[model samples]
Target: MSHAHDLVPFFEFHLYGKEQIPDLSNLPEPRLFSTHFLFHSLPDSIAKSKCKIIYICRNPFDSCVSVVFHQCNCTIIITQIILEEALERYSEGINEFGPFWTNILGYWRESIETPNKVLFLKYGDLTGDVTFYLKRVAEFLNCPFNSEEEGNGVIENIIELCSFKKMKELDVNKTGKMVGKYENKVFFRKGVAGDWVNHFNPWMVEKLSSVIEERWVWSIFLISLSNTYISIMA
Candidate 1:
């Protein structure tokens, strides 16, 4: 997902819809891009190549709440719609690409089974140690992260650039438009981890847990493997 203002200095091919993937023959071999497109729908090249895939996910309950705020604040169609209606629209996958669960599960499975290509990340982990994970991402993508600069300011730069507060404050993000027409959207909503604790009740949490158990077991494993890899690499 673009995650509102998350699209800044990092992007290339943006294929989120089912329409078409324009002529990429002119594009460079190793291209970078973001998409709400699920793994099942990704281009065949993605799976076969050595390209790195960073699949970031949050707890469904928290994701759902954040998504609610995102829809209301960013989307033109849902801006005037009631929260319930907006949620219904969300469940129906009326947004940028399609249904959230299907997309989430698709990547979850692919990332777990194919670790060399996909690196599944958690929003909570990134929030905890933004710099560390950013470095990990660099390593995963085979991008240069000079060992000589470990104590230097590189980490700080990335953290500051990618910080929720900073990204949200960007004039372009705060006012720029995307899939929807509303410009009031902010990429960084309360980027706190476990914010779901404040909103989810027993029933709701149980429901979300059941869904995760049924469809996201592989994703959970991928997260575990990712954590291990990060620790070892670090």
Candidate 2:
């Protein structure tokens, strides 16, 4: 499921302020859910439970670009603004589920403090070394592949099935509608890192870099990652 709302209807209801909380007693254990909600805003049950969270954060530049295209394709009333305006709003943390730094840092700190509960993954790192990270994820979920499974090419098959190209070609993804409105294909854009350079000019780069430098200074790891992205894409 793409979101928690698919299985737990009340998550959507709660998000929009509907009072009804659906009974989840019928759902089986080990239920997987995904959300864009901030760390602090998550339900108390989740905070207190022994559930694991895997947060995959993309470089802000690419994230902003992707959000722009996604909103424009999925929403009506033309939420798509010019890149310049989008960059301004993004830098100011005005977009959906933003301010980006706050959202990232909240999870970043939590992952540090409670490593077993939160596994923080960087999108760039995952794409760069899928095998290593995929194994990491499997291990994190307590289902690491045995040597027999590895020899049988299970990992390779899983990677190929989940690859962006393969997923984009799937009939369900190509023609499906999500949330009864969004075309599932909208989520399958370029699916590559560093595509932000095509959309960002020199000024935009400087502006976003300044924002990251200022806001992310507290986290050396994030700042280093941001700097590496800037350098590679420069």
Candidate 3:
């Protein structure tokens, strides 16, 4: 998902969504772009550039649920796709623009290897403390909040603007269209971090947990995220 994507002021495109030619690369200093491409598949120019990348990873449970909801709604006609099928595809990394593990772990690994260049944030942590992370984001992008900006409540204003309650109610989001397949309104589903709990049955939950263990257990990706202070504090 592109659920909270609207808050990012200037992403050229959601690379995971449609295969449109992105007009992003080589724009200037501090251009923002979003992508689901694995580290191996990322365009050579971007990987080699001095650009900073902010990649957010949601736990597989929630990511899978969100993608399922998104797929069900984006269809033109009613389809009875089941949770089991979605979970199976997700675990196998067979979903669109996936293997989900590859997309996630590739960034996770890069963020570990090049912490300064890739600021990896967890979706749960970000929504939990937008103020702190927003400040971190600004600082990472080299436009940190100064004393003057702090006094002006710039951080608070930015927090309120991107808050779920505020963003979901905006008229532009209520009506705007993107990439033709996704209606903007559909993107604003319940943004709670562990929303997967409400939808996943016991078997589905077990399968994802197993997949997570098998795929990430030995990987330094999530484990090493602590080095950059982007992962949650103990």
Candidate 4:
């Protein structure tokens, strides 16, 4: 299970929405579901229930650029030109759905508070140290990798299977229609991190950070909020 956008990257993986997931009320215990819904957006049952959320995040600049590239190549779904027009709009904080800062803060705050329920992952770290993070994720998922039997090759296998080049070449990813919308864009497109450096100028970076710090005060407040809320609500 994974995000709709994350589908092409993980060939042979199934994708589903939160509401569409099995009831789990009558089911046996362990369950798994990958979702795009943020912390506040999850259902009350799932929020209150015992379930792990692997919150994978990448640098906002890179994420924004990737989203634009992915959207542009796929049926003109998100008709925003990041190079000039969209960049102008982004500077003024005019976007399809508010700013990207808000979206990132939602998960960042969640990871800080509910450390047990949520595990924070950076895309840069995931690519740089795949095995270390994979082990951490496997442990969180309760699917411990047997290092003795597999001799660390198991981790490499998983990562290789999900690699950008490999996934892009697979029939399931390259040919199959994903989520009935996205096309021409494969799941894996230049999976390298820190690519934002090539695109964003120093001024742009500082300006974006300032905007984030100003626009997402709610997230900051939430993180420093009373323990009463955490005890009562969470």
How well does model 1 score by local distance difference test?
A: 0.66
Candidate 1 worst ten-residue window by lDDT: 7-16
Q: Ten-residue segment with the worst summed lDDT in candidate 2? A: 1-10
Candidate 3 stretches with Cα past 4 Å from truth are 1-30, 74-81, 221-234
Q: Highest TM-score among the candidates is held by which one?
A: 2
The C-alpha local distance difference test score for the whole of candidate 2 amounts to 0.80
Best-to-worst TM-score order: 2, 3, 4, 1
How much is the lDDT of residue 173 in candidate 2?
70
Question: Which tens-of-lDDT digit does each residue in 1-234 have in candidate 4?
Answer: 333344323211242333364444553456445655556766777777778877788876787667666756644544323544555566565655455665567777777778787788888888888778988988887788885736947777888877777766765556545556566344557878887677776767786677667766755776667555768897
Candidate 1 C-alpha lDDT tens digits along 1-234: 344424321232233333665665666666556666677766677767777788998766677777777756644443323544554555555666566777776676677678768888988888888777888888888885897677688778767876778767766665655545445444556779888666655765666676557555766677678879988999
| Number of residue pairs clashing in candidate 1, backbone atoms closer than 3 angstroms, sequence gap of 3 or more or interchain | 0
**lDDT (CA) per prediction:** 0.66, 0.80, 0.76, 0.65
Candidate 3 per-residue C-alpha lDDT over 1-234 given as tens digits, one digit per residue, 9 for 90 to 100 = 344554353233554345666554535644555666677877677887788988888988999878887887755432335777878888998965768777787887788689888888999999888888999989888889999999999899988877888888877777756655567877787888998887887888888889888887755555665555754453
Model 1 ranges off by over 4 Å: 1-21, 25-30, 74-101, 179-184, 217-234
Candidate No. with top lDDT: 2
lDDT-based ranking:
2, 3, 1, 4
Better of 1 and 2 by lDDT: 2
